[model samples]
Target: MKIRCSTFLNCHLLLFRLYFLSLLVFTFATTPEEDPSVIVSRFQKYLQINTAQPHPNYYEAADFILSQANSLSLHSQTLEFVEGKPTLLLKWPGSNPNLPSILLNSHTDVVPSEPHKWAHPPFDAHLDPNGDIYARGSQDMKCVGMQYLEAIRRLKASGFQPIRTVYLSFVPDEEIGGHDGAEKFADSDIFNKMNVGIVVDEGLASPNENYRVFYAERCPWWLVIKATGAPGHGAKLYDNTAMENLLKSIESVRRFRAAQFDLVKAGLKAEGEVTSVNMVFLKAGTPSPTGFVMNLQPSEAEAGFDIRVPPTADQESLEKRIAEEWAPASRNMTFTFKQKVSVHDKFGKPILTAADSSNPWWTLLEGAVKKANGKLGKPEIFPASTDARYFRKRGLPAIGFSPMANTPILLHDHNEFLNQAEYLKGIDMYESIIKAYASYVEHTRDGASREEL
Candidate 1:
C-alpha cells in the first residue's frame, strides 16, 4: 500500500537506522577485542620454545609467530638467509596508505645459557611469587617481543587500524651480530619496501633508577694480531723473538686500555663512552704441546681484541692509530693484523644517531614514559649495542628503549630476574607508548600516503 508523504519520510529514517545498525554489527564481527593480557600470555607461551643461537629451533618459533599472524588475518612471511635461522615478518594494513610506516623489530634468538645455573629452567616460563616471569630470554628480549605483539594485537582488536603500516620483524642471530638475521634483512629489498619513518628496537637494562635510552651504538671491530720470530734453544738470549714482539704489542694496547680505564674510573667517560677496547683472546707459544720448552723462543704468537669506536671515528683513524701507537715503528716488531671479514665488510662505517638528529619521535616517547608515572631520564646512548643499530644504519630513525622502571637489571649475567612490579609496569609502559604512537599516526596521516608508506 502507498504511504502518505509524512509517513514516507519516517520510513526513510527507519531504513537508514537499520542500515547503520547492520554496519555496526559487521564491524564488530570483523574486529577482535583488544586484550593486553592475551598478548602477554601469548609471549609467555612463545618463550616456552627454545630459540638459542646456532640452532635456536628457529623453525618452531617461526611457525608459532606465523600462526599468530595468520590468526590475526595479517600477512606474514618467513625470510631465510641461513639454513636453519628463519626471520619472520608480519604486516598490518593501515587505513591510510600515505603515512610513513613504523617498523617494530625483535630478535627471537638468544645466547646459549646454562639452565643448571639458573634457579629455574631457562626455557621454562616460570612465574615467581611476585608475578615476574623467569626465563632465559625474558629480560634480554622475550619480554620486548611480547610487547610488540600485544601492542599490535590491541590496535587491531580495537578497530583502530593505523594510518601508516606497521611491520613486525622477529629475526634471528642478533646476539651474534645478526649475520643471517637483522643484518641480512637490512640489506634485502624487503626493508627497502618499508617507508619506515620511525623504528623501535630493543635496549639495554639500567640497574639504577634512571632509564637509559640509546640513540647510537659503537660499531665492533674485532682484530687478531699475530707475531712470528726466531725459535731458538732454551739458553738463548731470545731477543727480537715472537714472545718479545707479542709482549710489546700487548703492552702498547694495554697502555691505551689503561687510559680508557682511567677515564671511566675518573668519570671522564659516561656510560656510552667514545671507545671501549677489550682484549678477549691471547695465545702464544705451546703450553703443553712442546712439553716445557721454557728456554726456547716460540715461532708463533697471537693476540685478539674486541675494539669498539664511536660513530664519529672512521676506519682510517682506527687503522692509523693502531699502526702508529699499537705497533709503532720504534718497537721493531713485525706483526700481522687481521680483522673479521664480516666486521670490516658491513660495519666498517660506524652506526651512529646524532644527538641533534631531527626525530620528533623522541618527544612521543617522552610523553608515554611520563604518562606511565615515569620521568624521562637522561637520554644515554647504549654502551654496548642492540638490533636498533641495523635499522639506524638503514637510515631509519630508530630508538632503543626499555620500560622497566627503577629495577635492577642483570641481563647476560648470573641471577638475572625482573621484579614482579617491574614486569607489570612494563605492560603499562608499552600500552601507553603504543597508544600514543598509534594515535599520532592516525591524526597525522589520513589514508592518503599509501604510496609514500
Candidate 2:
C-alpha cells in the first residue's frame, strides 16, 4: 500500500530538521582548552584577527606586530606607501652596521574563508583536544611570522647577539598582488638602506618527512581574447561569425594546455615545469529584460584565461606563439593582456636564486636546515607566485622556506589548522636558521671576528 501524501510530507520535514540539528552540532561542538605556551597563545590570538582581502584591519594587525617587537626589545617602524596598507618592519641591529642584513618576510593578510565549511569558527583560533589549532591563517603565513619573532625572543633571552642585522617584515596585499605591499617596500629607500643580502619567505608544508623549498616561481599571465565578425540573424549559417572564431581560438589554446598536461602525466615534467591555462569566464550575447536575445547573433565575443608559465619557458618566444596561433590577425581575433611579465634583468638572465653550490646563500641555508634535523627536498619553482620574486628580481637571494614537515598542505582550504607541537617545533628550527645566518662568516680574514671582517 502507498503512504498518504500528508504522512510523506511530515516524514520529509522531520528528516530535514534532524539533518540541520546534526550539522549545527558538527560545526560547533569542539571547544578547545586554554594553551599555556606564550607562543601558542599568541598564535591563537593572531588567528582571531581578520586581515583578509578587500578590507583587512591593517592597523590592528600592525599593533600586534608592534607589541611583539617591543616585548622582544627590537626597534620597529610601520610604513605605508599607499594610504591604509601598512608594512611593519622590525630590526635587531648587530655589532657590524655595514654588513648586509638578513630579511625574514611574511604577509599579514590572508585569503577569505567560509565559516559554514569549517569545523570551528575560522577566526576563533580554537585548539582542539588533539592539539590541532584551527584558524584561517594558521598555515598561509601568520604562523611563520609569529615563529620568526618568538625565535628571536628566545635567542635574546639566552644572551645571543648576531654579527649581522636581522629584520622582520610583515606586509599586506599579497593575496591579490604585492603592488601595494612587498613590491612597494622592495623599491623603497628604507629597504635599500638595510642592504639586504639574504631573505626568507613562506613556503608550502610537506605531507611527507622532507621539507619543500622554492628558488623560482611560475609567472602569471591574464589574457582576454576578443573576436569581431559580421552580425546577422540566427537562422542562416555564416562563414565567419564572431562566436565561431572565438570558439576556434579557444580550442587551439586548449590543445596547447592539453599537451603541457600530458607531459606532467608522463612524468617528464613536474606540475611547476609545465604551462597551465584555464578559462575564467566568457562574455557574449545581447541581454534583454528576461534573458539574451536568441533571434539575433552578436558581432563580438570574448573569452578570458588565467595562464601560468614556468621560468624555464622562453617568455619572448611564448608571446610570439600567442600572436601567431591563439589570436592571429588573419582570423579577425585580437587579445588584451591584463598583466605582463618582467622577471628579468638588463643582462637577460631570469631572476631566479641559485640553489646550487655556487651560491653561498644556498649553501648556508642547506647547512642550517640540516643542523635543525630537517631534510629538504630538491628545490622546485613555486607553482604559484609570491612576494619572494620581488627580492630575487632586485638581485638579493631570497629563499622560500616554511619549516613545516610531516604536515598536510592546507592553505586556503576549509578547516585549515596547524598542530600545536608542530608550531612550537617550527620556532626551534627557525632559531637555528636565524642564528646561523646572523652570525655567518662568508670569508673572514685570519684573527678577524665575523663582525670585524
Candidate 3:
C-alpha cells in the first residue's frame, strides 16, 4: 500500500513538471518579442516609432532598424553626415561582390501630422476592421522601408544567394529636404565606394490596378520677388506704390500659372510634364498691435513662389522671363532665385533613367513585376523631387517605385492609410524585384558569373 501511494505521487509530480515545462515554452514562443516575425506586426512596430519632423527621433529609429539588420545577419552601419541625423546602411553581400551593387533607399523621416485630423492617432498605427493600417507615413514612405526588409527576410529564408550585392539605405530629413541626409550621403565616400549599378526609391501609390514608376523628377525652384515703391495711405491711390507693383508681378505669375494648369486640365500634358508654380507666401504690411496697420501701405512688398520645372524645360528661358516679365527691374521689382535642385548630372545630361528595353535594369524590373502578378503603368516623371534626384545627379540610374496598386494616392494627406492586403502584396512584389535585381549578371562584363560555392 505504501509503495502504491509513493508511485502515484511520483507519477503526478512527473506529469505536472512536464505540463509546466510545456506552458513555459509556449509562453516564451508567443511573447511580444516573437511578434515581429509577423509582417504586419513588424510594420506596426516601425510605424509606432515617431520619426516625424520637426524633431525626429532618429536614434530610436536607427536602433530598431539595426535590430532588424542583426536579425537578418546583414552588415549594418549608421553614418551621420550631419550631426544628430543618422543614415542607416545595411549590406547583404552577394556571392560575387565584384559585380555592381543594387541600392534600395527609403527616407525614415515623415511629415508631421495633426492627430486630431486622423481617424486613429497618427502614431497609433491602428488597424481597422476593413484591414487598413492607419498611421502617418503609412502611404508616404514608411511602408516601402518595411517592405524592403520583409522582402529581404523572405529571400534570406528561402536560402537565396545573390549574384550582385544588395544594400538598403534608410535616410532622414527627406520631408524638409534631403540636404542633411540623402544629398550628403550620395556625395559621400561610402556611396562612391559601393559601385552601385542602380537605385530603387519610393514612388506614389496608384488609384488603379497598375503600379506607377518614375524615371525622372521635376526640379524645385523657390523664388522670392520683392517690390519697392513709394509708400502712402491705403485710401490714397498712387502710381507705382509697393502693393501696386507687387500686384502687377502677381498678375503676371497668375497668367503663367493658368497657362501651365490649362495644359493639365485639357489633358494635353500630365502634371509632371509641365512647369508648376504656386504662390506660397505674400508679405506687405505695417505691423500694429491688432494685426496690421491697414491705414498705410508698406514701402516694400514681397511674394514667395514655389516652382517646379521639368527637366525637359529650358531653364535659361524661364530665368530670362523671370527677369524680363515676372519681376522686371523696370517695374521696380527685385527677385531672388533659389534653385533647390539641379536637373542635370555632372556631365550636363538630364537626370533621367531610361525605362525602355535599352536599360537592362528596367527590363529586369518590368519582368519581375509581371512575375509577381503585377502590372506597371507607363513610366512618367515624378511631379516632385525625391532622393532619387540625388542619385541621378551622380549619373546613376535610379527608379522610383512603390508597389501599391488599387489604392488611393494619400501621401502626406489626412487619414493616410495602407490596406494590410495591399501591404502584404507589396512585400511579394519586392521579393520578386529584389531577387531579379540581385541575381542579374551582365554577360558582356568579365567575371560576371556567380561565385562558386
Candidate 4:
C-alpha cells in the first residue's frame, strides 16, 4: 500500500514517528487537577494526551480509560493485536450475558497538526470562557470517546445497569483507516464472542440544530496510477513521454471527477450520492540542484487519488471505469490499489443497513433518539469514510453518530473545536442512547438477521 500523507480523515501517514514522538513530552504535561468526575474536566484531560497518529499515545490513554472504567466498576481490557496499537474495551455488563452486546466505538487517534495554524496548541485542549474548547481531537473525536465513558459514569451514578452489556471501544489509528485497529479486532474471536448486536461509531458534526445519524457511508478507494516512458532531455519533444501520458490519464480522471461534482452542484445528487475523486498527490520530473525546473525529463510518473464511492454504486462498474477510462492499460498506465472496499459481505448481499423499519435496530435507535428529546435528521450515507465500515465489513450493523449539534464540521481543519455546553449535552445524549439500547428487556428472536439483531 502506498503511504499517502493526509490531513486527518484523509491523511496518508508521512513524517515518521520520531517527528510526532518528539512533541510528546512537551504536549504531555498534565492538566491541572480538576474534578475528574466533571464531564468537561474529563474531556479536557482526555484531550490533553497527544494521541495524534502516526504515533498515538495509546498507553497513557488506555491507562486513564481503564481507571475510569474501574471507577464505574465496569469490566475492562486492552487488546493489542499489532503490538503498541491498543484497543481499549470497557464493558458495562448487562443483566443477561446471554444476549448480544451493544458497542459504542470511537477512535483514539487524531491527524497531525501544525501548531502555528491554531489559536491554541493542537494538544493543549484549551477551553476559553466562551465555551469553545480548541484542540485537535476535540471535535474530530476525543469528545465522543470521552463522552462514552462520561455517559456511563452518569448512568452508573444514577444506578442504571443496562440489560444488554454495553461496550465502549477506544481504538487506535482510525485516522489512517482502522486496518490495524478495528479491522483486525472485528474479525477476531474476541469480537465474535461478544456477539455485537449493534454498533455506533463517530459521525460528522452538524452545522444545523438537527442531529445527523449515518446508516451508511461512501466507501473508500485509494489508487495510485503510474506511467512509464523513455527518459530524455527536456528540450527534446518526445511523443508518449511519461509526463504526457500521466497528464492525459489525470485529465480523463479529472473530467470524470468534474462530472460527479457537477451533479452535486446542480442539486441533482448529494455529495455522498456520487463518486468523488480528488487528486491527492502527484510525482514526476527530476529535481534541479538549485533551479525551479529540471533540465532533464524523468522516465516515470505517478498520481494518487482519494476516491469515495457511494454505497449504491456498482463495484464492478467502478473497476471497469478505472480500467478503461482513468488509467487505461492501452495508455501504458497501470493502477494499483491502497484500498478498494468490497461491495458485499461474505453472504454476497449488498452492504447497506437500514435506519428505517427494514431493520429492528433502526426502530430501537430512533426510539432512543426521541426519548432523549433530540431530533434526528433523515438518515443518509456519510459523505466521508469512517471506522464504522470495518464493523460493517463483518456483516455487522453499525450507525455513525457524533451527537455534535450546531457545530461546524471542523474535523481535520485548523482550530478544530467543540463547545463546552455541546460537549456536556453529548454526554446526556449518549446516556439516553446507552440506556435505551442496552436496557432492552426483550430478547432478539433466534436466527435474526444481522440488521435485526
Candidate 5:
C-alpha cells in the first residue's frame, strides 16, 4: 500500500513537469522579450497604419499609441487643439520633477503616397527576405515614433530610472505644415507646463555611414505671381502682354535659382545654405473644350513658385528683390506669399541650436552617440522645413536628428523603405541618448541649467 501511494505521487509530479516545460517552449516560440524581432514587429505595426495626409485616421493612430503607452505603464493623454486632429503625449515621470524634461517629437501624418508607383502596398509595411520594411512612413517619421517608445520599454524593463522626465509627443499635420498640430501646441499653456528643456525632432536620412544632424532648417515661402495686361492675337507682339510680363519675371527667378543651384553643384555651399526656388505651376490662356484658345492671348497669367530660404539669408533683401526684379509692380505683376515661416525667434534671435561644446546638451548628445558606436556628420541646415522650426521659434533648443546611416533619403519618395538592421540600431541609439539626457543634472552659470542654455 505504501509503495503504490509513492508511485502515484511521483507519476503526477512528472506529468506536471512536462506540462510546464511545454508551456515555456510555447511562450518562447510565440512571444520574445526584449528581442530585436519584437522591436521590428512594433515598428512594422506602426508603419501599417495609414496616416497619410489629406485624410489621416488620427483617432486610430492615437488609440494605437495609447495602447503602447499602457503596455509600458506610461502616463498618456491626447489633446486636440484642432478638432479631428489629435496630438498624443506619453510621459515617463522621473525621480526629480523639478528638472526640466526632454521632449522627443514625431509627427503622425505622412505625405501622401502613390500606391500604384510602389513595389509593395504603401500601407502594408511589408518586410522582405532581405529585412527591408517598405511603407509610406518607413523613413519620413513613423520609425522615430516607434523607436522612442521601444527605447523607453527597454529602459523600464532593465529597472532604469531617469533623474529628469522624458516625454514622447506624436503630433499630427506636420507633413502639411504643423499649423493645427505643433504650431498650436507650442503656443499652448500645456506645452509651457511641461517645462521642456530640449526637443529632438525629425531629420532626413543619410546617404553615407555618418548620420546627419540639423541645427537649423530652411524656411519655406510659397509665392504666387500674377500679371495682367492687354489681350491680343497670339501672333501680335505687344510690349506689355500678360504672358510676356510673366515670362520676364520667370527669367529673373530662373537666374536666381540657377545661381543658387550652381553654388551647390560647385560645392561652394550646401544645398540648404542657399536660397532654392522651383517653379511649381504656370497658368495662362483661356480654356476651351479640349485645350486653351490658341489664337487669343489671355489678359492674365500667373506662376507659382516654391521657395526655400536659409535662416542666415537676408530676408529683407530677398523680399526687396521679389518686389523689384522678380515681380515688379511696374511691369503689371503682383505677388503674394503663403506659408512663409519666420527665420527668427520671438526675441529676434536666429532659430538655431548650438551644436558645439558651448552647449552642454550638444556635448551630452555627442557622447551618447559615440557610446552607441555611431558617428555624426558635420551639423548642417535642413534643406526643408520640419516641425522643429515651431519649437525653435519659441527660443528653445531643438535638434533635428534621425538615426539612419548608409541609407538613401527616401522621404515622400516611391518604394520608401528602411532596413530592419538600421531600424534596430536606431532603437539602441535612442536608448543611449534618452539615458544620457535624462540622467544629466548639470547646471550652467547664471543660474541656468544645461538645457536652458
Candidate 6:
C-alpha cells in the first residue's frame, strides 16, 4: 500500500494558507483612530521643549518622547553622538514578520529663533485666543513629530498592530544639514536591519486647503569662487583685475538667476521649483582700521554662491560656463573653486517616485487626503534637499509631507507659528493617511504579484 504522502502534504499546505489569510483579514477589521485634542496637547508639550539647533536641548526633548513611548509600552532608545545631543527611536511590531517596514521621521532640532521677533516666545508654545500655537518649530516640524507620536499611541491603544513594522525616528541637526544627525543615522546598521520600505519626512506647509507630499528634491551645492588678479595701484587703469573678474562672474550668475526667477514667476515649474540661486556670502580685500577701504586695489577677492539646481540641469554645463566666463586671467591671475562643507561629503542621488513603480503609494496617499475632508490638490515634488533624500538613496520610497492648511511659510525665519485649527486638523489628516496605507497594504499588498523576494 504505497499511499501518496504528497496528496496529504498538499492538503495541509492549503489549510495553512487559508488560516493565514483569515488572520490577516481579522487584524485589518479593527484599527483605531486617534483623538484630535490629545494630538494638539502632545504637540504643545513637544513645542515647549527647547531643541534649538547647534546646541539643541536633546536631553529635554528626547526624554519627553521616550516617556510617551514608554506609556505605550514601546521599547524606545535614546541614541546620542555627543554628550548633550540625543536622538529618539521607537519601534512597534507587526503581525506578518516577513513584510516590509515603514518609517515616520522628524527632526527634534529647530533653528534658533528670537522671542522678541515673534508674536509669542519661541519656546513658550503659547496657544492664542484664536487657538494658534506660536513657537519656533511649530510649523517647520514639531507638528509632524507630535502627530507621529499621537497616531502610534492611539493605534497601539486600540490593539491595532500593523502588518508591516513601523519605526519612528526623531533626529537632530536637520536644520544644519544633518551631518551629526540624519546622515550619520542612515549610515548605521539600525536602519539597514529594519529593511524599511517607506519613509515619511517633514516638508513645507500647504498654501491651499490640501496637504502637499514631496517625492523629489533638487540637490543643493554651495560653490565658492576665488579670483586673483594684478595688484595695481588705485590710480592705474587695471583691465583684468580681481574685481573685474569677480564682477563678471557675479553678472553671469545674475543672468542665470534672472532666467530662473522669470520661470518661477511665470509658474512654468510647479511649487518647489529649482530656479533660485542666492549669493549668501561674499568677501573681498582686507578690513581697514575704520571700515572697508574703497580706493585700495585688493590683491585677492572671493565670494560664495548658494546654488540650487534642478535634477534636469546638467552640472557640467553650468560648471563650464562658470569656469570659462568667470575664470581668472593667466600669468597675472589664478582661479580656485571648492564645495562648501556639509554633513554628507557628497550630495544624495535625486529621487523620483516612478509613475509606474510597483507601489502606487502616492495615489493611495491622495485618496487618504481626500478622505480626511481635504480636497486632493496637485502633488508637487520638493525642489530643495531634505532628510528624505537619505532614505530615498537607500531605495526606500520617501515622501516629504506636512499638514498645515492655508498657512504662510516661515521656515528658517522669524515669527513661525501654526493655527490651532490647522494643527488639530493635521492629526485627523495623518490618521486617515496611516489607516489608508495600512489597510491597502494588508488587503491588496498581495494583489501586486510578489517580485523576486
Candidate 1: 10-residue stretch with minimal lDDT: 339-348
Can you list the residue pairs that collide in candidate 2?
none
lDDT score for residue 447 of model 5: 69
Candidate RMSDs in order? 5.4, 19.7, 9.5, 17.4, 7.4, 9.0
Q: Give stretches of model 3 more than 4 Å off.
A: 1-37, 443-453
Highest lDDT model number: 5
Alpha-carbon lDDT of model 6: 0.73
Model 5, span 142-211: residue lDDT tens: 9999989988888887678999999999999998889999999899999999988889998889989998
lDDT of 6 by residue, 1-453 (tens): 235687788889999999999999878866645456666777888998888866777888888988888888877888876456677889877666566666789999888877777877898888888787888899879898888777666566566667767788999888888877787788788767876666789878877776676766666767777777767777788877787778777888888888888877898876356545778777787688989777778877777877766555566776676667655445233444444222221334345544224556666777777888876456566766678867665545677888888988877778788998887777767777776655545323344432201
Candidate 1 CA-lDDT value? 0.71
**Please, what are the lDDT tens digits per residue for candidate 1 over residues 34-126?**
454555567678888898766788888888888888877888888887777788888886665566777788889877888888888877777
Residue-level lDDT of model 2, residues 113-217, one tens digit each, is: 999999999999999999999999999999999999988987886678999899999999999988899999999999989878788998988898888998888
RMSD of candidate 2 to the truth, in angstroms, is 19.7
Clashing pairs in 5: none
Better of 4 and 6 by TM-score: 4
Whole-model lDDT values for every prediction: 0.71, 0.86, 0.90, 0.84, 0.90, 0.73
Give me the runs in candidate 5 sitting further than 4 Å from their true place. 1-33, 444-446, 449-453
The TM-score obtained by model 3 is 0.89
- Give the poorly placed runs of model 1, Cα more than 4 Å off: 1-40, 287-292, 329-350, 354-357, 441-453
lDDT per residue for candidate 3 within 354-376, as digits (tens), equals: 87877888889999999999999
Please, what are the lDDT tens digits per residue for candidate 4 over residues 73-136?
8888899989999999888889888778899999889999989989999888888889899999
Poorest stretch of ten by lDDT in candidate 3: 444-453
